[model samples]
Each structure stands twice: as structure tokens, then as C-alpha cells.
Target chain A: MQDDIVLKTEDLTKHYGGVHALDGANFELKKGEHVAIMGDNGAGKSTFVRQITGVEQRTRGKIWLYGKEVNFTGPIDAREAGIETVFQTLALADDLDVPDNLFLGRELTFWNWLGPFRFLDYKAMRQATIAGLEKTAVKIPNIKNTIRNMSGGQRQCVAIARTATFHSRLTIMDEPTAALGVQETEQVENIIRQLKSVGEPLILISHNMRQVMDLVDRIIVFRRGRIVANLKRDETDGQDVVAYITGAKGDDVADVA
Target chain B: MAETSHGTGGLTFDKSKRAWPNELNIFIALILIICIFEALGQLLPYMNGQSLLFDTKGRFDSIFNEARIKIIILQVSIIGIIALGVTQVIIAGGIDLSSGSIVGASAMIAMSFAQTELVNGNPNPKAIFGPWAMDLPAIIPVIVGLLCGMLAGIINGVLIAYTRIPPFIATLGMMVSARGVAKWWSRGNPISFPTEDYAWIGSGMMPVIWFVLLAVLFHIILRYTVYGKHTYAIGSNEDAARMSGIKVARHKVLVYTIAGMLASFAAIILSAKNLTAQSGMGLVYELDAIAMAVIGGVSLAGGRGSIIGTCLGMLIFGVIISGFTYLKLDAFYQEMVKGFIIVAAVVLDQWRQKKAAAKT
Candidate 1:
């Protein structure tokens, strides 16, 4: 929660063949800040995240992570640079058990080279998995169940747990609770609060006004590939936010949004 | 759906601890097929009028019957070797139709170099090879066979990975080209009379032994290794896997190359077993191998299935074929029935997936 400027984008723009997805947009985030990004379905919220997370290359722009200019060719590059994303699709291997899914790529192992053939430190991994689930308050009764067997809420929780475990400098959740029930959504909101309390920077892409207002310190309204209004949580009401999201207001500010 | 728990807790049903009886399911299927055969033997007058699994006549050690079983396993094992790698390919969300063609091509290419120079101390009339290829170490033909497989596999991997061509199309193209090369290798004649050392490679049930051994080895690798996990992950979700820092394209190439090499090795075994290599050696073998993979519970959709399943699938295939022969059914009828079973296996797989998806 040190008020250090951790990430900044300078005239960040992206285009798709001739479609101006993001036109000379600029944004910034300080350390430990929870920022909410809101926009209509066609608006550039996802495109912006894609560019920033290196899921897609920007047609034209510069991105700064940890105040250093960085160009990422792919999401792996972004991840290696300390960016973890919980995409809306919930990219989880449905076939694997919970603990296995938790530590998918970067598995913790003993005996280095012999790790694959060597015995997995199951107790340690299981214990750590349990602790992670507990910390996120994502109760699934059994951690051995595969994601395919779990409820939507549990799957969402597992994806979130991955972010927590990785401890990325910037965590981008693309509508993390889009498919959850009321109770599960509330649980996710609570986890977001826990994230805020720990001073972890998060970029929450959501349409839920109540959740956004309750969770974020600042709201960045995007419309037609432009950041129209950057307002403090108290400055913007849900109605104004909806106006921006739906092109009712802030149309005059910029055609990009 | 029921709630489950873990550790020393009440109502704790750890799903992982509750191992899936996938192998058991396969075993049950095998038994059911055998039971049908037994029932037919009793009902029909011309079924050798005996038990299905055992040779009731007591003419031999039942090892003769066992030998037939071994042969079926042996015949499929060569292709089963290729199927091992193919199972991984299919599990990783791709199909390799070219493996069959790779077998024929690699077999022809390797045998050309395996020809003996002196037939009774004179120049061998049937030799397509130069004198340099004659009397080489046993390792030469084996190495040549393996190299052809490796080369074919690498090409498959490159086309599928780098060019971003669909696996089916790329492998289909390879199928035609490889088979053509097989015919062209010895000008449409069969290559025969390999050295004594080469013959030992596929002597008796060694192909089956190698198949079983490779299946076990690969099964362990798939279950325990990083390569295995990544293969599953990539199959499950390529985008997510890539984002997770797995080199998806490179791994895919490696997988296909391995598959190609396995098919060629199978070819090498086939040549040794038959003592000849004809252009038509591996014709329709791909379909049978794929059928075995499907019957083993390998979802063509990827991200599921096991080597053990495929092995069981091969057994099922063998039993069905054996049943047809025991019943004195026409060879044409058996071929027709086999085609039906392959389609049926796919349908069953689709239905099971639908049911699972519905439940979820």
C-alpha cells in the first residue's frame, strides 16, 4: 500500500485492421489500488485488458509495468513480468483434481530434475492448497474434486486461488464473478476486499455497479475504446457510471470510448 | 450431486481417493464381449462347439490358443506402438492419420538399406540396395527404421505446429505421400530376406512385449511427468496453457514427431515379423489404431483417455476379430462389423460426454 506508481500507460492505443479498438488512450494505477473498469459489451474494456496483459498486441501504444517500458509478445511474457489474469472463461483444466489445477504450470517440487519421476510432496501441496482455499474463503468441502465436478462458484474460487498463490504485482480479473450465484458473488466481493486490505493492485472488469462501488477506490469508464471518465468512487454515482457505459453521457468527451 | 470432504473429516469423500474405475469398465466390456461369444458357441452348431476363451479339445497347451491371443496382441502391438503416440496426440487435441503411411514409407525405406549383398556368397538378385548396405550391423536397419520414423514425426510436428495447418489435413497429405514413397522404394515389389539379426527384432511376441512395455512407460510418463501435465493442459485449453507459460507449439511438434517415430518402429517390427515389406503393409491400419484409441475411452475432443484404456481397446478389437473367425463368419462381414464398432464407439463417447456435461 505504499503510494508508489506501479503501472502506467502512455497514449495506449490498439486497432484491429481498420477498426480503432483503442485510440490514444491513457491510464495509470498506483501500488495496492483496486480499479474498476466499466463499459458496454462492444466497448474496449476487454481489448484494453488484452493489450495490457499481452493477450493481444497493441496496434500503437506504450505500456509500463513497474514504471518500466515493456512490450509483451504474448500473455506468457506478461505473466513472467508479474501479471496474472482470471479471465471470464475460467481457463481451468476440468480433468485435473483441485490441487493439480492450482499448481498447473509452475509446480512446486523436490529433487529438481527427478521431480517429475520423484514423489510429489503431496502433503505440502495439499496443505498449501487448503490454506489458499481458506485464505480466499472458497469452501469446497473437498479439494480432491476436479473442476468439472465442482459447482460454478467453486470453479471461480479455484481460478481466484491461482491468482492469490502466484502473488502477481497486478491481478486482472475479467468479470470474475459473472457466472456466480448471489452468495458466491458476495463471497468473491469479500475476497476482493481481502485483496484490497493486503494492498494488492487489481484491475476488476465488471458490469455490477453495486459490486464496483462497494469494492473499487476509483472507477474508469470506457466507451468505444476510450477512457471517457476517470472518477473517484465518491464522485461518480451508479447512474452516471451507467450513462458513461451506455453512451448516454460522455459521448462528447471522446469518440474513442 | 453429492457433497464430499477430505482428510479425517466426517462425510469426507475425496474424489481423487475414489479412483475412477476406467480400467474396470474396460475389463467389464471385454468380459461382456467374451460372454456373447460363449453364448453364441453354445447356441450355434458350427462355433467349434466349445468354450470361448479356452481350447476345449485339449489338443495343445492352450498356449496354442494363447499363441493366437499373443499374435493378435502382437499384430496390433506394432500399430499399438504408433497408437501409443497417437493416443497422446489425440489427447492433446489433434489427430495423426499419417502414422499409418509413415509405417509403410519407413518400412520400405529402411528395408531397402537392410538388403543383404551376397545371396549364398553371390550378388542378391532381389536386392534394391547397393553392396554398401549389405552385411551391416543389426543396429543399422534398426537405426534406419527409427531415423525414418523420427524424420517423419518431425515433419508432421513442423507442419502441424509452424504452418498452423490442421493435423488431419497435414497428416492426410503425409499419408498419400508416404504411401507413394513406399510403392516407389522398390518399384512396386515387396522387399524381402532381411539379415538374421533384423529378423530377431520382431521374432515371436516381441512386438507385443515392446508395445506393452512402451505403453507402460508412456503411461507412467503421461501420468507423472511435466510433459504429460502440459499435454493435458494444452488439450484442455490452449489459450490458458499458453498464458500459463507452456510452450504449446513446440510441445505439439514434439508430440507428433514422437508419434511418427513410434509408427515407423511399428513398421520395423512388422517387416521383421512378416520377413517382407509390401507397399500395402499398413493400409487401413490407421483406422484400426484410431478405433482402438476410441474404444479405450480416448475422447477425440481431447483432454481425457489413458494408455491403459487404449491397450484394453486393442484387446477388445482382437477379441471381436477372433469371435468373428470362431463363428466362421465371412471376412467381408467381419470388416463390415469392425467399421460399425468404430462408429459405435465414437457415438458412445459422444453420448457419455453429453451426459457428463448435462450433469455438470
Candidate 2:
């Protein structure tokens, strides 16, 4: 319940029928801290992120954000509560242009008295989109081109920019660079660095050990639905994190339940 | 990169890379078809030369053949109403096969409410209801027709969104059921003798007026409204829409419901204009409406069309029908040629998509 603790979760567990996708995860993230979630496939890394972002319902868990206990019904609720996420799927409407995709769900509207019949404020959204892109130092050749025509890196940058544009309290990204080329990956990493320079808190889920070590202050390793190890970047190496991920090392937090 | 050279304000637009707007392309097609018919009018030997859309002999007050133009506009207007709704449904990535049947059922029900108490100083012989329902206001019948459409749309939306049935199958079921309702409404007999107020709604060029008004309203709605954006977003990528926190299922219901209301409105106009309604009304009208949307450049794939394009498509349909009759072509040939045009439009759509994809 401290002001510095941006997000805290206790006993977060999700079971898909017989499969325990995520179990007994007790985690905490402080303000301005960058944490990396590293695990192999089916190690509950994505599942854990989904639980926090309300993309899926948790079987039983308590999540506290900025000292307030909250339960999200859907992704929208989480987003409204200042939790922005760059999902692994890179959820961008292919036929919509940059501004449209950036303001997809939460569009700015004029004619407030018209209630549900309000019109989209295209000019305002375009301006904000331009500002967001500039803030992230991302250059797009054409803001009017649909996402379908954009390069993979440009799409990824759009998603990241969406998270940044909203001035969210917490940002979570899952495998953002998985599909990008070397240069594109560097561009995404630079965006992340920008977030850090602004003193923003972030949770990055990546499988690349090098990326995890280079970008995050702390690395949380998950193995078989539980937090196996929480290692500081300065105190631990890739081998130590992998040892815990592969279940060769004992659990660092004994009281996960 | 050449396309990105044009700067407006601080941002550059790839205007050169952009193809002509779909609506513009459809408008051009409409003009080309008219020109072809005009050429045929001059080239063919029909005892004497006659213009297709012009009054060469100065028979009318206007420069153009106002009579033929009126006929073309009037013939397409009723069905064009249904196409307006079908365009939205298709843009939302769904199909509604029930629109035509909804039209039939709604027209029959609405006319029953709209009938006068006495026909020429006698009890109405074709009344579907008792005197209590007779001589109702025009708005009563209009609302009744809209409700019929709305109910059918809700069922279609629920089935497609919640039950997860394919839109084609769900709407097809409604299509058959609605047609049955139309027949059962009055034992397959036509309902006639609509009240004077109701009759005025569809008198003469009123249908065309209604079509133009609705087309303009929907065109703006699709272009500038939040509802329009959400509809396009859902059609463009449903998963992305959901992840962005859009209520996909509920939105689907809204889209189908609106489409149903439009179809019902079309039915009301058709029945009022005819001064009667039959169970056989609007038979195959759904296909015509859909054909209009597709021909206008509304993609069957969804999320990539406009109301303007559909309107232009409607005009093309009107021209083809009118042109065929002017050319003295058999009615049967119209069907064959219509089929060819529909297939060609879809082929063109696929080519456009591929070209857009290749540009990136």
C-alpha cells in the first residue's frame, strides 16, 4: 500500500480447466522500475500478464494499483484505470490509418450534448497522434496510410505509441520485438529507453535473455505457473535466470502461496 | 516514397499512391454505362434513331429525357432503400439474407394497420384486421414496419454474435421464416385500401425523396460518427476491435438491428407506394439490394466500403435495367447480364486488394 509501489499482486492464479496456466504468483513493481518477465513457452508468462491486464479472468487474485484494490472486468476497464498494454498480437486494425488505430477504442468526440450520437474529433486525434509519434521519436512516412501498408516495425511502434500517448500509470508489453528484424528491434528498444528516461514504470515479457538483461532493472523468472526467481540485473547473470527457468534451481520466494 | 512527397501542415501524405476513391470509381462506371447505352441508342437500327437519356426531339421541358430518368430513379429507389441497410451490414463484416423477406413480411403487416375503415364508402374487403386497427395514422404503420424489421435484426444479430453462427446461415434462416410470416399474415391474400395519409407517403416521387434523404444521412453517419468508426473497426479486424475494448457482440447486434430497420422502412415505402401488399412482395429483393451494394464497391469482405459507393452502385443498377429495356433486350437477358456484372465487381475488388497489398 505504499505510494512508491505502483502495482502489487497477491496469490494470482488462473486455471484453464485442468491446466494451471498461472498459479500463486505474488509480485510487486515499484514506481519508475523496469521489470522483465522471462520464461519458456507455456511457462505462464503471458498468462500472468493477461491476468493483470484483465484480458482474461483470474481464478482468484487481488490486484492493487496505486494503493487502490481493483478488479477489472475487461481490457477497457484496465486501460481506463491507467494500465496500458502492448499485446503480443499487436492489435491494430489493418484498414485504419495511424490516427484511427491510435484512438481506436477511446476516440475523441465533439458535440457532447448529442450523447451517443457524438461525432469523432478527427482533427484532435490526428494532432495527438502526431504528438505521440514525436514524443517517441518514431518516423512514419505517411500518417494517413492504413496499418495494412505499414512495415512490421512501424506497426509495433504504433502499438507502443498508443501505450505512451495515453500517459498511463503502468505499461505492459509482451514479446514486442519477437517478429521484428534487427534494426526494427533496436527501434522498439529505443522507445522503451525513452519510457525509462521519462521515469515511467514498465513490465516487459520477453524470451531474449540479452534484451531482459539490457532493458530491465529486475528479472522475474516463471517456471510451471509459479515465480521461480526474482533476480537483480546487477546481481545475477543469464545462466542463473535460465537455471531457475528450467527448474534446476530452487524457488527463491518460499511463501508464494 | 513518391507518394509521400506531398506535405500538408507538418505531415506528409502518400496521396499519389492512393487509388481513386471507390465511390469515384463507381461514379465513373455509372457514367461509362450511360455512355454505352447512348452509343447503342445511336448505333442500333430500330426503325429510327432514338436517344437513351436525351430528348432529341424536344418532347420534354428538360434537356434530358425526364420521363426515362424518372422511371430509372423510381424503379431503383425502393430497392435502393434496402441496399442502404445492406451496405452497413456488409461493412460490418456480415450478410443479411433476410432483408427481402423482412420487406415482404413488414409490408403485409404495415399495410394491414394502414388500411382505411371504408373503401369507397363500404367496409374494406381486403382488410387484414378488424375496424379497431383500421384508419390508423401513417406513423402507426411506419412504426409497425420498423418493429418487424428490428425484431428480425435482433434475432439475426444474437444468432450471429452470441450463438456464433455464420451471418449467412443466421440471416438465411430469418429470410425463410419471415417469408412464411408474410404468407401467414393474410392467408397469402394481398392487403389493400391503405388510409389516405399512409398512401401519401409513397405517392409518385416520394420514394426517391426518401431514398436520397436516407442515403445522405447514412453517408454522414458512416463518415463522421463514433458508431461508424466502431462498425468499420469491427469489420476491419474483429480481434483488434475487442482488444481495443470494443464490445464486439453488442456492436454486431446494433449493426444488424439498424440494417433490419432500414429494410423494414423500404417495405413500408413499397407497400404505401403500391397501395397494397402481397406475401410475394420483395421476392429476390434481397439479392438486388446486395447486388447494388456490391456493384457500388462495398466489399463482400467488409470494412472497406461507403454509402456513396452503394448509391452509385444503385444508379448503375437502375441504368442497366432501363438501358436493357431501351435496347429492346429480353428481360431474361437482364438477369444473365446482371449475374455477370456482380461477379465482375467482386473480381475487381479482389484485384484492388491485391494491388494495395503489393504497394507496401
Candidate 3:
């Protein structure tokens, strides 16, 4: 338990009735460090993320955030504990506008004494949304337009902005650029760069080697439900990471029980 | 910062691109329907050219036929209350087929509690309970009605949310069960002789007053409250709502429960206004309430409607029903025409959705 280690998981395992989607993932992320999780399809990358974020329950594991052992009941619990995630699906309510989607679960309200009858502070949420979008240099033609009308890139940006807007302690992105075009992908990468500039810690789950190498300080490769290799970005090449991912190379460290 | 257009040739803020609000469109439809009926009043050779809404023949002091207007408003008001709740359910991507049945069951139960000890200086002949239950405060019966509706709603919500049952099937089950309860409550006999206080609740345009108040309250709730936002969010994308940390199951329960309470309130008003309750009360009223919501522009697909639209839709229904009678149309023909109108409204909604999609 050290202040420098932002997140630690030991023996984290998930089984879907005999299918071990994630197993014995012993990992650590340091304060202000960006890490990439790379694996082939069904290599347990998303499953590992889900376990950490409490999107799914872990069969056997321990998670420590900021050096305190914590268990999350749901995504809301993880979020309130200062973990923000941009899921692979983007997770935007299509019919809601930018501000509405940004503040979906955690809306700002006035007339607090009204309890359930309190009114949404539309002006405040709108202002914060604009500021958040500007922080990531995301351009949306109309913030008032519903997410249904926005381009794929705009929707992705909004989801990312939501993570950024809340000033969350840890941010996680899963395949954010998988569905974006070349230019949109660069736009998302720039947002990640902004996060690095602000010295915020991030965990990115992606398959693109070049983007991973460029954006993160460390790369954690997953192979068949285990962490096969942990490579420092400056000391390893894409081929080395790919070698571990495809099982061409053996685990660099013993797989934890 | 230079705005990057992302190859869209620069995003243009075209005023014309903005579609008219759905509520405005509904309001316009209401006016058009009224105009059509007014034109028909002049065109149809109905006993020497009588006006439909206007007192053109000098039948009343006001420019409009005050009596006909009152009747039209009064007829729609009771069901309009139910439509308010139905609008919320539909907006949250759920349906409440039990609302009409809830009305029937609540009316029968509430009236029994609201009964006076003596009917015209004699023991209450229609009393379902002994003197101990007789002449309770009007609030007691109202609360009884609301609790009944709330309980029914909770069952519907739990089935849909926790059990993962489709809203249509869950509510349909409640619909049948509630109607049975209504009949079983008094063994299929009508309950009458409500206390004077209870009777005053539905007397003389009170139903209309209640409808207006509830409509305004719900309109604000839907437009401005956190509950309203979650309801719309859940309807728009339930998984997204969950990921955003919304309590989807609990919220569903709340929405359905509120809808049930509204339906029960409508029942209370109906029974009080009639001074009696029958097991047959509110038969097919669910369809009428849903029709009002649909006609007002509440989408069956959910997450894209308003209380204002439903209110305007209610007015259109009232006009159509009143207009048909003025035109001397048969009841069966009116029913057929009402069915056609409901179908047409949904078609129009689909068309509008497509057009909106195309614009983007």
C-alpha cells in the first residue's frame, strides 16, 4: 500500500460458468501514469476492465484504489469512488442532448429542499458541458442537438468529455477509437494527450499498437486470461508486445495465483 | 480556436433545419380538427344550419355554445387524468394496460369507504361494510384508492424490472387481475351513498379542475425535475442509463407506481362524480387514455413525448366525440372514426421521426 500506486489488483479472476474470461491478473498502476491494455479478441482485456470497474463481479480478487481495499457493487459505486470509464459501446443516451447526456446520472439541481421535485440546473450543466468539451478541444456544432444526430466521433468525444468533466481520480477507456475514422481517431488521441498533460492517470484498453505506444508509458499485454507481459513503452517495440499477445513469447513474470 | 468542421464543409446553423416542436405540431392539429368540425357544421344540412362550437344561431350569450363546451371538456377530463400517468409510462418505455382496471377496482373500493352511515335518514342500503367503516373522512377513501393503485403499480414495476418481463405482458396480467378484483370487491354490485364531503370532490366541473392541476404538475415534473430526466434517459437507452449509474429498476417502479396512482385518482373522481361505483366502471378506459397520449404525440417507442402534447391530444378527442354527436353520427360510426384517428396519429408520428432522422 503506497500513495504512488493509484490502483492494484491481486488474483483477480472472473469465470462465466467454466469459461475463464479473466484469471489471476496481478497488476499495478502508479499515480499519474498512463497504461495500455492490449489483447486479441476474447483475450480477457474487456473482462479485466469490467472486473476493475465493477461492471461485473469478480469471482476471486482484491482491488485497492489509492491504497484502500475497496469492493464496488455497481458502476455507480465505482464512479462515486472516483473511477470514470468510457465503455466500448460509448454509452450515450441517443435522444438526450449534450448537456443532458453529460449529466445523466449526476445532474445538477437547484431548489434543493424540494427533494425529488428539485429542478435541473440546465444553465449550470450547459456551462460545464461547454467547458469540458473545450478542455478536450472537441468541436460540436450544436450542444443542444440530441446524441442521435451527432456523428460517431462527436458521440465518442461527448463520452470522453463526461469522464473528463467530473475530475475523476482515475479514467478508463475501452476501444474508444475502434469505430472512428482516421481523423476522428487522431482527435481522440489528442484528448488523451490532454489528459496526460494534466497529469491524470488513465487506463486505455485498445488493440492499436501505434496509438498505445504513442499515448501510454507502459503496455500490459493479456493472453488467454492472463497478464503475459508488462513492457515499458521506451524499452519495448510493438513486435515484442505482439509476440507476448500471440503467445510467441512466454510470460515475463510468473502468473499470479 | 479555429472550428474544425470534420469535412462537413463547415457546420451551418440553418434556422430552417430546426423542426417544429412536437407539442406545437399537436396543438396545430387540434386547431385544424376544430376547424374541420366547424366547417362541417356549416356544410352539413343539419336542421337548418346549426353551428358546432359557436352560438351562431344565438342560442347562448357567449360566442361559443357554453353548454356543449362544458360537456366536451367534462367528458374528456376524467380519462385525461389517466392519460397524464400513461404519458409518463410511455415516455419511460413502458406501458400500463392495467390503468383502466385500476380505475375500476379503485372506484369500487374507494366508494365503499366513502359511503355515509345513513342514506336519507336510513341505514345505508348499499354499504359494503358495517357502520364502523361508514362515513370515514373523504381523505381516507382517496388514500385507499391511491394505495391500491400504488400497490398494483409496484407489482407491474417489479415484474418488468426485476423479473425482466416485457411491460406489455406484465401490465396486461395486472389488467385482467384488477378487473377481477373490482368485480369481487362488491360481488359485482354497485356501491352508492358516498358521504357529502366525498361527493363534493367531483361535483360541478371539479373533475376538469383536477385534470388541469395534475396536468400542469406533471408537465413541470417531466420538463424540469430529476425524476423526469431519468425517466426519459431510461426510455431512450436503458443500458446507457445503467452505465451512467442510474437506479433503473427502482426508477421504473416509481414511474409505474405514479402512473397507477394517477389512474386511481381518476377513478376516485369518476366515482365521486357519479355518486356510485360499478365493477363495469372504466371498461376500455385504458384504451381511451392511451389513445389520448398517442394522439397527443407520445411515442410508443418511448423517450420522446410531452404532457402538453397529451393535453392537446385530449382536446382533439373531446372535439371529435362532441363533433360526431353534433353531426348526428351514429355511436358505432363514431367508434370506427376514433379508431381511424388513433392509427393515423401513430402513422404521422412515424413519418415525423423519419423526417427528423433524414435531416441529420
For each candidate, C-alpha RMSD in Å? Answer: 3.6, 2.8, 3.2
Quote model 3's TM-score: 0.92
DockQ of each: 0.37, 0.47, 0.41
By DockQ, rank the candidates, best first: 2, 3, 1
Q: Summarize candidate 3's per-residue lDDT along A155-217 as a digit string, tens digits.
A: 898899887778888999999999999988988998899889888899999989999989999
Off by over 4 Å in 1: A1-3, A15-20, A23-26, A59-62, A108-128, A243-257, B1-19, B55-65, B120-122
| Cα lDDT tens digits for candidate 2, B129-175 | 88899888789999999999999999999999999999999999999
User: How does residue A96 of candidate 2 score in lDDT?
Assistant: 88
Chain A TM per prediction: 0.92, 0.96, 0.96
TM-score of each: 0.90, 0.94, 0.92
**How close is chain B to the truth by TM-score, in each candidate?**
0.93, 0.95, 0.94
lDDT of 3 at B360: 53
- lDDT score for candidate 3 against the true structure: 0.89
CAPRI-wise, candidate 2 is acceptable
The digit string of per-residue lDDT tens for model 1 on B1-360 reads: 245443222223364666566677887998899899889998897655776576676776452466556656765778788889889999998998988888998888877777777767778777886778886777888888888888888888899989999999999998998899889888899988788888888898788788878999899778767778778887777876766777888999888888888898899989988878899889978888998999998989888889999999988998888788878888999899999998998998899778777876
Model 2: pairs clashing at backbone N, Cα or C within 3 Å? none
